[model samples]
Target chain A: MDRTEQERLITENRRKRELRYIATFVLMAVIFAVIVVLNINTGSVKISVPEIFRVIFLRQGDKVKYDIIWSIRLPRIAMAAILGGALSLSGFLLQTFFSNPITGPFILGISSGAKMCVALSLIYYIQRFGHSSSVIMILAAFVGALLSTGFVLLLSRKIRNMSILLVGGIMVSYICSAVTDFIVTFADDSNIVNLHGWSLGSFAGSTWTDFYTALAIIGVCAVVTFLAAKPISAFQLGENYAQSMGVNIRLFRVMLILLSSVLSATVTAYAGPISFVGIAVPHLVKRSLNTAKPIIVIPATFLGGAVFCMFCDLIARTAFSPTEMNISTVTSIFGAPVVIAMILKRNGGVKQ
Target chain B: MSEYVSASGLTVGYNGRPLIRDIALSIRRGEIVTLIGPNGSGKSTILKTLTRHLAAIGGTVTIDSEDLSGITYKELAKKMAVLLTDRTRPELMTCRDVVAMGRYPYTGSLGLLTEEDQKLISDAMVMVNVLELSDRDFQNLSDGQRQRVLLARAICQEPQVIVLDEPTSFLDIRYKIELFGILKKMAIERNTTVIMSLHEIDLAEKISDKILCVKGDHIEHFGTPEEIFSTGLIGTLYDISPKAFNPLLGSVEMPAPSGEPHTFVISACGSGIPVFRALQKAGKPFAAGILYENDVDWQVAFSLAAEVVTEKPFEEISDEAMRRARELIDACEEVILCPVPVGSVNARLRELINYARNAKPCREA
Candidate 1:
């Protein structure tokens, strides 16, 4: 009721709103610059920044620059951005779905599912079908991912405890790894070599087709998820509260898990298992946004993912030059330490 | 048509083990039905089964003749709200936010709160006297405040029946009285059936309209509290010996023999709450020296209050704690006891009793 206190309340409200918008704008600008500069400058053949922009927009570059810019670097950059965004967004979704901060897209064996399918395609199925394997590999990966997701969901219903559910997921991943290994043992030398490279995860092999494919899936799923944000926020409270809120808990849970798995599985099929970006980027985004409201965190996560993956790709290519390190190797070096720190900090904290 | 929620031939358990077998019971509208029994006596199991949280192995539960299984969850939400004992939630949501969750069943797919829903939530908060605390984080509230918030949340659901599991366990005396008052008002004004389980047998006896005495393996008795109380069913339920007497207010207390001298506790109502525990902890033997006819602590003195001599006018000590102390000296080889400040009427009980004892020849102070 006092004038000073009333003035203070208005000032505080305006400050928070302005701070949030400013943070969002800054992050978006940074991500755009990182994607453009990192992809253009760090590849095997570099082009000037102005040339890169012209080739991208006005199509006025020389033949070599055009080919490098259009044919190789752009698609690779796009692939890294899309896969990064997809993975982190999926990570955010999975964490909320399970009500446990430790959950990620790959935590439930989806990466292993895709890995097994890719290995099977490279070794046995591709040998028989010659050059017709990508389609088969995609289908196999989708099915494998679906199966793993179904298993996780079923076990979750029976088990009720999130810790046990996480353990079940890890067990399934281990089993899939074992089966993939068994298949690899009998494959020919060239097939083994090809499968091994694919398993390390790369943006080097991306083409325009891969970019468009990933973009479409990521776009559709992201839209669906954005629309489901309200229900997801309700879920953060608890299932009983969500159900009482007129949310069909079973249906929303299934949809969320399926979306996250599909996004991660598709990305994994194309990019191998890119480590930590999915698990770590969302946390980073949430920390920056200071609110886990999906409306804000979801977009922040997508942009954060893009910048993080692009930067990681730059590190992967430039660290040793002429000897490209696995993107996962770069990500793990940066991401795993942050994750370890979070786990240590969580020891004295309340768990979800 | 049954004016009650009834289970016929109900058998409930987990993994093929029936915890409660072939039971039949009904709870009528506007009645405060209490299920009193020891731990693992199937009290919570019955509440769970009634709420359909657990399915019965061999019976049908019907509310107003509609089979429980056939009813939709939203419809059931309207009919009854079941409160479990566990109170933890992951999110540090506000009390209002938690209470608004009760309106979920009525909300549409969008889950937006309607004006009416908001009103109901506020009304529930007011009823529980937590309106001012609505904006506070639910996790930050004291146990008693948190309890009322939960009850408010359930009330916001606006169910025809309310069932609580140990609702008073975390409450202080003041909050406990407030909660029971709210429950009573809900039953009287809204004609809603109220059922709860409690370890406080005497308090339950005072407030409950109907008492379901669960003992051994089945429903030992179900009737009006007066009928059950007169039968001394509560006495047998807890295994307190029949020597428990209440000189005032007909409350129960353990009485020592008239000639036996005992360091009778001169404590009053709330005073005796901790005396029993203290006596048990110290392993001391004491008895009621003298208790008044209507002294509220007489409940403490009458039941397990203490071993005592009955006196009239409640406040005027019949024979002082000193005379009773001397008698207690004769009965016990030694006495170790504490004093309770019941009220001004008999505040001298302790000093008088101390005066009655002389320094022991070999005992140190």
Candidate 2:
């Protein structure tokens, strides 16, 4: 090729790369806006889209509808975004940290531990306490998550391989789940009803208070993770490589686990431990985007996760209409196929 | 004078095995040092211990006379860059993004690259000749190109000391020479101390300012190539056979002693080279009766300079050719043969081997 032709080719390549970045950002923003709008409009009442917007932005609605729109639908949607973003971002961090495609937010057993705590609380006095039970449940979930993380850390110290630690986490999860099941079998009628709802997972009980509580936790975790994205990207190369680059690998692993646990447990306490969103959304983001770097993948996962949950919730509310299916069931319908395809694809083997 | 990196009485290991035991080594400024050894000889262990990837078990490794452990991770990053022979990771990253990571120590919260930093990165990519690949995905490159891209990333780190393990393992012969040339140039022109492990002995000898040969639990010898390349030392180091040198090749020949001879046919230009050397080493003698000039096999014959009866390309043989061939064949107890790709031009060679096989089977033939 001639010099001018070569230069033009180089310039054209650079322009295309720049356009891809811009296009991805624009698409994510458009999806985020659509998810927010769809989330606000869908609920038990068939409210008009413009009317819901007026309640949200213009303040023109009846007290009952306003209460339902502002207090119920808004918080539920906001919680979905917060928890979705949190779970998926946590999944991105875990995937990068483990350098494994199959690694998800719940792989470290913190989600299972949080689920166990919420199950324990639900099988005891959850209905008796009502709204106050949310606060107690969140604290218990946080403690459970921390305990699980501590156990994983201890087992990690014993094993040199990351895969071994992952197996240890899964084993701990099984043990905790067995104990929770045994506890549920012996509980009273009221406890069983509460446990069933929590286990199925829903944003049905979301309130403004719950949204703020989750937002505070998820927001702080997100900011910290955003700042940590570069180091986490370094981890994608491997722990030894990251350490050689002067990343404090020991401290970084602990920080990642702690932050991810807070995000997962907060969502569990507020929205009652949804499944599939954390494990499946990051893989979908990776498959679509074809990049594992946290700087790009983290934000993409956040927006992607929000859109995924919002769409799933839309399906859950509309498919059954008056009956109302659990959010997890709807998410799994979309999520399972992706999980299966990933397992079958080449180079899809996730690190332990 | 301050050494850029110095480890005094340093001991490092895992589970009390002491992989590197009480070793004292110092790297001065602007030198290309090479560590050469067999597998599991603790060459990598020593490098890791010095770089602070593995903590010293008993002694201190001081960079610029400061305790290495006391240096902050960011500060240590400014002092050194390391490239290891692990699989390259292809994240959602372009080659530029991967190289830009070297500037992470200098980047702020926004991770923005300044104009000067951009120039450094470009310069690094150019030095390693990966500037064209800057826009391509790192995973898409050939193994040689990928190694250079990674080297570009390390150069972008702009550290004083660069440590690499088997950097040329994936490279082709030309790229391997080019990489060593760049490394040698960096050591001299930029005053960077470069330490790397290499299996390419000839390349290492040509480029390295000093060589550290590790074998069997410790540093066997550490010196200049000329200081360490004596025949006795090399023979002992590699456990080579043949107590004395070969007068023909003027190099050590490690070959198995005599075994029963088997007639063989080799037609390759370079393929016959190994068999000829093997025959010489095992005390088996052979004679060549026919050859043509300007062929690859002819080059091997010329290098070994073996005696052979020759004719011009595509020329008909006379009574003299038949007489010489018969004399050489009669001297040998049996005939070993070879075929050259001389088409119908040398159809007589194929006929000769066929004739011998048909008439074969004498007592030690």
Best by TM-score: 2
Instruction: List model 1 lDDT by residue over A1-352, tens digit each.
Output: 4434533553465367559757775967676796667678666787888887788889887999898888887888888888889889988888888777677857778778778877876676658865544456666677777877788888987998887898898898888889888887888877877777778888787899878877887899988888787787667766655554445677888899778877887787888877777778888777666556576677778888888888898788878988999898998898888777767766656555
Q: Which ten residues in a row have the lowest lDDT in candidate 2 chain A?
A: A343-352
Q: For model 1, what is the C-alpha lDDT against the true structure?
A: 0.73
| lDDT (tens digit, per residue) of candidate 1 on B1-365 | 13668878888777668877777778778888998987888888888777766677888998867898788766887778766686555344567767776776777654577878877887898788787775566767888888888889889888888889889988998898998998999998988888889987777777898888877567778787788777767658766665453312444553433433333443444454465445534545556445555545455544443365666664555455456555655555544344445456666665554554552211111
lDDT score of residue B127 within candidate 2 = 81
Q: Best-fitting candidate, measured by DockQ?
A: 2
- For candidate 2, give the lDDT: 0.72
The global C-alpha lDDT for each of the candidates, from Candidate 1 onward, is: 0.73, 0.72
- C-alpha positional error of residue A82 in candidate 2 after TM-score superposition, expressed in Å: 0.3
